[model samples]
Target: MDSSSLIASPSLARRSKQLFLGTRLKSEQLDETMLPKRVALPIFASDALSSVAYAPDEVFIMLAVAGATAYAWSWKVALAVAVVLMAVVASYRQTVHAYPSGGGDYEVATVNLGRRAGVTVASALLVDYVLTVAVSISSGSQYAAAALPALSGHEPTVAVALVVVLAAVNLRGVRESGALFAVPTYTFMAALLGMAAVGLFRLLTGTLPQVESAELQVVPAAGFEEPLTTLGLLLLLARAFSSGCAALTGVEAISNGVPAFRKPKSRNAATTLLLLGLIAVSMMVSIIVLANQMGMRYVDPHQLDQLRTADGSALPAGYDQHTVIAQIAGALFADFPPAFYLVVSMTGVILVLAANTAFNGFPVLASILARDGLAPRALGARGDRLAFSNGIVFLAGLAIVLILAFDAETTRLIQLYIVGVFVSFTMSQLGMLRHWTGRLREVHDPRTRHRMLRSRAINAFGLALTSVVLVVILVTKFLAGAWIAILAMAIFYFLMLQVRRHYDQVAEELESDEQDSVMPTRVHAVVLVSRLHKPTLRAIAYARATRPNVLECLHVDTDTEETRELMRQWQESGQEVALRVLHSPYRELVRPVVAYTAELRAANPRGVVAVYIPEYVVGRWWEQLLHNQTALRLKARLLFRPAVMVTSVPFQLSSSHAALQRRERDLDRARPGDVRQGRPPRSFTRR
Candidate 1:
């Protein structure tokens, strides 16, 4: 048989995939996919930027538990979050320059701390990435429901669909998805900042109108009817601050994606990190301040009982409270409805695109873990589009499961957010501190030492801030949902440790030895036969061609009549190979064959036994189920015997001719990446 006939041909599924994902690119074209600064911003920073849409809402929701009086502390909380965001961004800038291989925190922790520390950081990041997708898409679904009432009561379905679409877009390739998403991300930034600017101007001119919720009175929850003491106030403020820290969820993506940037990758990534921090902080603080000044009141969506009318009466039935951005936009552009819709719509779009950051970051981190033997090797393979497609699909599946489990409720899912990210942040910053401290000892020059010391200070400050934030998040949200994230991190850590151990064991077991080079003393060949047909003849001829020391045809006697017919056909065919029959009184096929092979191996332990099984090749999938069952079982049993080699000789059926022709046609057609691979047009002329 010609080897070319075995090559798989392009099928309907392959064509459909090409149509959906676009043409495939060669590996040599990977450098062509590198992102510029403008594109990289939206690809890696969209999550941090989009956090403004919900971070402010979380802050207000946390404070609303103590009535509207607590709203005054919103700006202070926002300021603290901004300070931490800046410090983190500064710390990661040093990280990118020091280790620009796209390993980000995992690399820093592994090199400086140890493999366990690195695996810890990797687990934290993985959990956080999945949560990022779930939370962002769920929030987007909320906004979508608010904008289109028809989508109400079906947020989970909508969120799941959105996740699927995002996964498809990302599967196309990073550069293409980045380009497709750049407009929405940028428009979101412009709309939000522009609304803030307009609102500030109206405030100075004494013409800013109050939001719809301004007249509504907030009812304090139980035990908070009066003013609080210092301890109580501090605890309440800590909860609010922890919720607001969601703004810093995506700041580390730039460091994780340094390799995706163009030349001077580290410098470009560091600059993008700075831009993300500045933009995200500016938008977050602006929303918080504006909402406070405009008397924007927000509570948990499910807890509408906390709100009352201005007349001290219970609110109307089914009163929908719009999000902070929606209310602010509605008031800011009361006269022009189009501008209001633009701001609100773009907010929703950005929330969904924010998941793109996780799509980009999670796969890169998973690939790094794979290279280090902590993850499955499949996660490190590039797909047709030169993307980490296996990792992308894995992340999408996880996000979808979370969305379905939580009913796509943003508030509920938000409780599980921030814990994993902060864990990675604190560990990475601590690792950086050690990294700089060790570097300071080796540097002799005064200038270099001073620079290292400065970097060390920045990392130290970042470590302190992130560690405190992490403790606050765990304390405030443990009962809420943060423990779920912690449990997930622990599971991932243990699984990865086991995976590394398994890989190490396999490597040690596969090490070459002097005995591996020794040749077998003799070769005994056995051809499995059932029907003494064309397939059996081909297997026997191929076995004979190998010129073994001994060869025979073995058949199991299950049905007496069938066995007699096979023996008669063997005699008529007049084959050179001898025939051996094994009787099975219980009508078993696999056991009798296995017992015979074992006896042969025990007789000559120094010789190698070669078993050739004839198989039928069918084109249709259903036809495959009707054939190859016995051969498959025999091969499985024979594979376990030491010094035994199994061979499969396939006889193609008439149905397979169509597949052979299709393969030939596919080979003649030119593919998309052929030019980059320096391959000429393929032409096959029949003689």
Candidate 2:
């Protein structure tokens, strides 16, 4: 058939098109769904920006391991972390330019390194994506619980619900969800940066107040009271830097989502990456500096005994310590309580929105992996909303599982978070170095070669810096729960390999062969008669309509009386087809039919056996349960048999007709603009 003729045929296209229209977007509408820079920033940068809320706490918490004596190094650690962030951002700009297809690290490593490198990057990225959702939402839920005491005990539930809601927004469409998230994202940036500006001005004017925790002295962990050895101090510093590197977790997302941006996708993505790095660094440094100036003390909540009063006595009962950001905001805005509340509220909202970046990045990366046969093919498909629905659901489900498992505690989850992201970061930069080296060999122009060389140098530096950070993270955090993330990465890596192997095996087995192209010798048809009802009659009629070589009515004698009555009726009705009954000693329904079909197929090895089973189409829930049970089992069994075709001839009952009419009414009731603008009906699937 010609393409134009196929398009014009209603019978061939209408039903199939209708089945998918509501759940899938048309190929032509893809461009309309592309995100602009304004919307793309929030969609792709929220996670990085939101990291500022908790990264500083992680830094201080690590320093608290050695007590208040080590707190002076917090700002220096933050500075080092900021420097690393700049290098990563610069490295990723080159990545986005080279790979504007939204593959991110996985693509960079695959093309420049090798398949194993690509799979490793993919596994790390997938794990990081799940951790981002878990940590972000969990932290957000923590802030929310603090704000509303009633929610304190239900943080995990709230976190899971936020994940579900975020998934729904993302499944709606990228541009649409981006637009929705833009408000809170922008609000958060403004609130945080504004707080920083106001607090800095207050400090310059000599009016800044100390934090509430400033009065409490932090007791050092055992053995830290004595003078520290060189090894101990170095390990403490490494631990602090590794913890602060949490701010760098989401920086790779912009590169992963380059294709989602409008025209000049690479340039736009690069610009967004720079903006993310600058904003995140600024916020993180500001928070860290502010915390230092206010003398904020952060420690594991379980180790509350480490905090003592000014007299070196223990704190009073129920002395709950707020987060570093929370303490800073409260101390900075002591007089203006509403501003503190605003900052707190926006911080929580922004943290939840931060997970949206993962929602955006994970699917795009998964789609790339799927295309490369490293993941399920379903992850590669776009839904009715033109988003990767399967990947989104998969990420959300994994995140929810993690949240529930960890009781929505950010501190615990954060330990497993940065390892994967940094692994991808270090490997990606190394791959970029290789990429630039290969490109330099092919380029002859002086200016272009110089630029390529400069880019290669930047990536080389990024590789060195991130490599150190990755080592530090593994060393400092390995025993402290980071091993879970490494184990998860290993699991995903092998699982993808298995999935790819299965897909390859299926593809090779299904490959066309000239020798196997010949037609069947003959077609033998069998109509399964469960009862002499309207459905059975319809099935028999449909089977006869096919006009096969030989036809017979088959029945399982599960009950002798019923079989006898059916056979008598067949004889009295004078049917041309003979009734074939197989007596079942065990009185089983599905097994007898399966055995008969297999026997017939074995007798005619070269012939095709087509089985027609009567199925009722009912509307009400209970009615549906009452029918199709036996037919479903028979079809399921016959589907695995070679040369056997099971066709369900559905006899629509009166309720089914009503249900069809109701569906048509719902279709007609769609938004007027949807029809007027030539858009198809939207799928009600919430992804």
Candidate 3:
């Protein structure tokens, strides 16, 4: 190798390493304190808590269509939805106890039902994770507008901004943000209870007043006469109740995150499940009750004209409808400005933070799927803190796409919600039943038998309730947009099955053969040269360095002029090797190369053909696109030929110098044993 080539090798290696930075993590660094209960709740259950932010708003919005008469059903629907949530929480609590390894619904279904069912559960949960971010962020932005008037008419911008921020925090690692957010998440619950108590006291004293906007009349959309039939009214009530049940969406997160909990993992997970459900239920019920008392009315943003002014004229355009929790905050803190803003601000912040649950849950679940060989191996890659970095980026891309597509409107996005939650709910409860049945035969104690039986009954009831709700969500929302979610689930299921098949096929192919250790009968070295440049010279030298027999220079003769000149030059230079030019009338590279290799392999079936091609190494990442077109294609075609081996003899040009400098700087900034490694990479440490 020349002096210039020697320098280039180190430069190219340095740059190649940069693409892989921040991707590798040590497993040992992923420990328990990384997931304390407070942070874990926000990290895992924020999706559930944030639902209370807008689920109540939807309840009031739908009911207000029928005038004040519809307000009476708010608490009833909230209680009914809570019953389902409580049952689901109880079932998942059993799930965590039964399977503390952290696969959650997907694991449960796979263990009990089989692989297909597990894939179904996985697909469902994947869809749910995306919806969790979309719905939560959009709803949070809705709340943000109420607290700060400047945010009006910019809901999508605010929602997407929040999603972007949440994605960054989650990509950093779950434990870090969990520790940071535990107080704020808990405060959301505390604030809801405190407001509920204050509202109750004011009600008892006959001093509770309605919200300022609540008195504005809500004219029903251009649909039916005011006096409706019992069946029509009940169906509308069912639709409203089903929408409200979005509050139950994130209850299964604890089951998914049991492995993140402290020792006595099952117990801790179960207790967390209980805590999340109770807190979510209380907040949901309180908001609904308060909205009803305040006489709040809302409608689909597109149907705002339905809400008329007191004089029977249309309410003005651009009239902002504050959500239920916002309305309650405005009413309760009418006298306390700071208290009012704090509740509204945190409520908005918590909504965005709620997406954190999806961010953490998605990557973890994806890693499990990848480990099981049912997803792309990239999903298995962990971050510097041993978190699933690829999975986080994947979730962010999906959420961002959905946000942009739907314009981050909660009203439109809400239609796609709840389907994934119910799918997992029904499947998990079924898995739990199978779980208890499997455990019953192994247990000898009578107390154990009785407790198992009780758990089974609760799960069975939960299954029944969730099944009904799933049907209701589908019936009411399928046309409205839930079909898109169902389609997404189906697509994910099939794609995962294909991934598993690919992994299995690869494993089978990679299995050792009896002749794997055998040396080749002959090593035929072919130096593929396109031009007489530094890269070509480097390729020839590298191939010669290997010192193989039957060494020859092969070129695809696309045009007459280049091949003749190359041959003349080879002769004039008195080169030791002969130049063999093959004419290609079609001027194609990959096909002719493939055909040539096949011919060589046919002549010597037992021999190995090692083809060396010179490739350019560039400084800027984008500069890579400008080079290596033919070599990349050649490598790809050669890969399919089992007998042919391809090697890249990279020739780094001076343009690659910048990339080398950047890597050297990065290495210095984050050297091993440096204090900057405040958190070790968990992925590398684990394996």
Q: Please give the CA lDDT of all the candidate structures.
A: 0.91, 0.87, 0.80
Q: What is every candidate's alpha-carbon RMSD to the true fold?
A: 2.5, 5.5, 4.9
TM agreement with the true structure for every prediction: 0.96, 0.92, 0.86
Q: What is the lDDT of residue 334 in candidate 2?
A: 86
> Model 3, which residues run further than 4 Å from truth?
1-25, 143-158, 213-230, 298-301, 305-318, 512-521, 529-549, 555-576, 582-595, 614-630, 649-687
Clashes of 3: 13
- Error (Å) of candidate 3 at residue 14 is 11
The candidate that wins on lDDT is 1
> In terms of TM-score, which candidate is stronger, 1 or 3?
1
Q: Candidate 2 at residue 120, lDDT?
A: 95
Where is the poorest 10-residue window by lDDT in model 1?
1-10
Of the two candidates 1 and 2, the one with more favorable lDDT, higher being better, is 1
Per-residue accuracy of model 1 over 1-687 as CA lDDT, tens digit each: 111123334576688999899887889989989999999999998999989988999999999999999999999999999999999999999999999999999999999999999999999999999999999999899888877899999999999999999999999999999999999989888999999999989989989889989999999888899888899899999999999999999988888999999989999999999999999998999899999999998987888889999998998897989889999999999999999999999989999999999999999999999998999999999999999999999999999999999999988899999999999999999999999999988999999999999999999999999999999999999999999999999999999999999999999999999988998898999988888778888999999999999999898888999989988988897877899989999998889888887888889999999888887776666666555477666677778888889898988888787778876677677777667667645673332
Residue 13 displacement in candidate 2 (angstroms)? 22
